[model samples]
Target: MTEQHAFSSKVLQEDCLDYTPFLSSVTLARRRAARLVSEWGHPDIAGDVALVVSELAGNALLHGRVLGQLFRVQLILTAAAVRIEVGDACGERRPEVRNPAQDEKFGRGMVIVDALATRWGVVPRTVGKTVWAEIDLR
Candidate 1:
């Protein structure tokens, strides 16, 4: 039997945004990430991942409180899994998981992501932190 090739790709690097309003840029980045995953035969996972990226990136922009540091988003797919990575210049701060009541508005993002992601974590780089999540594709 012939072996099927795995797929992996890196985004062209988006420009960082000011931490004032966090809508347009975050949405755009999430869309691109979703599209990349969809091409790898996981459109279902893409939606959940899109939201995860949005929330993580949003937090980085809104709460991490850094300036002029463009974020990097990367997608990697293999026979067993698909991985999403979002890197920002907020190495000093790590993201915290929160639990909210059924009627609560905030703190729900990470909860949803945790439920969907097979694995997730925050990795510190020399200058920043990378928030990553992985979904099983099998």
Candidate 2:
């Protein structure tokens, strides 16, 4: 099932998907984000946007899992850019690049996000924080 939020943040279109903090939810969020962005007429960036959502959602599940709390994945698309936001229930832990060694098997999600997105950052919310990335479609 899918649900949307009542938001009017900008001139462009927005879509939101909320899910339980589970390992499988990350893949769900990624697929939803790709479909939404493609429907919004930005198919070229669907893969990147999906990757960003996966990374953020995976982080939420792995690091920000709060009992009885749900996370959110939001996509905002416009003529020039597409913004993806993933909100989780943990606020204390912030996202950063660890610059792991080349042989490390993990710690590359955010690095991939940084390389794919034009800009990305985290915003602290009342209960948690939202990690967002914007990709230029121009």
Candidate 3:
């Protein structure tokens, strides 16, 4: 049997936005991701996309922020999948999935991201890094 890929190389639809590294930006990113996925005719995955966007964007704001720099969110839809990417201006920091204590209030963002996306990874950019997650449509 042939192995099925989670995402196609050909992009069918794409949307991108840049936001200031602020707390509100994470909410905006989540909303935008859900709307874009729904508009692209994949409402079933909208909630998952939104959740992943929230985690990635929140991580960028909290750990990857640089003064005067904005974090960017990009959504790319293919026939078989949707990919969400959050780019920030700090390459030195990398995202990690941590298992926090039961009473801990934070450190669960990457854990959520890891559980939701079919596949996720970081791509190093010239000045920073782009954290990306993909959800399969099939």
What is the per-residue lDDT of model 1 for residues 4-76, given as tens digits with 9 covering 90 to 100?
A: 2233544332223233334577888788778877876679788887887788778777666467667766666
Ranking by TM-score: 3, 2, 1
Poorly placed runs, candidate 3 (over 4 Å):
1-8
Task: Write one digit per residue (lDDT tens) for candidate 3, span 22-48.
Answer: 899899889988988999998999999
Candidate with top lDDT is: 3
Q: For candidate 2, lDDT tens digit of each residue in 9-119?
A: 464888887999888889888888888888888788899899989998998888888999999998888666788888988999877767999999878888888899888
**True-vs-predicted CA distance for residue 47, candidate 2, Å:** 0.5
Candidate 1 differs from the real structure by a C-alpha RMSD in angstroms, to one decimal, of: 7.3
User: Would you list the clashing residue pairs of candidate 2?
Assistant: none
Q: How does candidate 1 fare on TM-score?
A: 0.76
lDDT against the true structure, per candidate, is 0.69, 0.83, 0.89
Clashing pairs in 3: none
**Angstrom error at residue 28, model 3:** 1.1
Query: What is model 3's C-alpha RMSD?
Result: 3.8
Can you rank all candidates by lDDT, best first?
3, 2, 1
Q: Is candidate 1 or candidate 2 better by lDDT?
A: 2
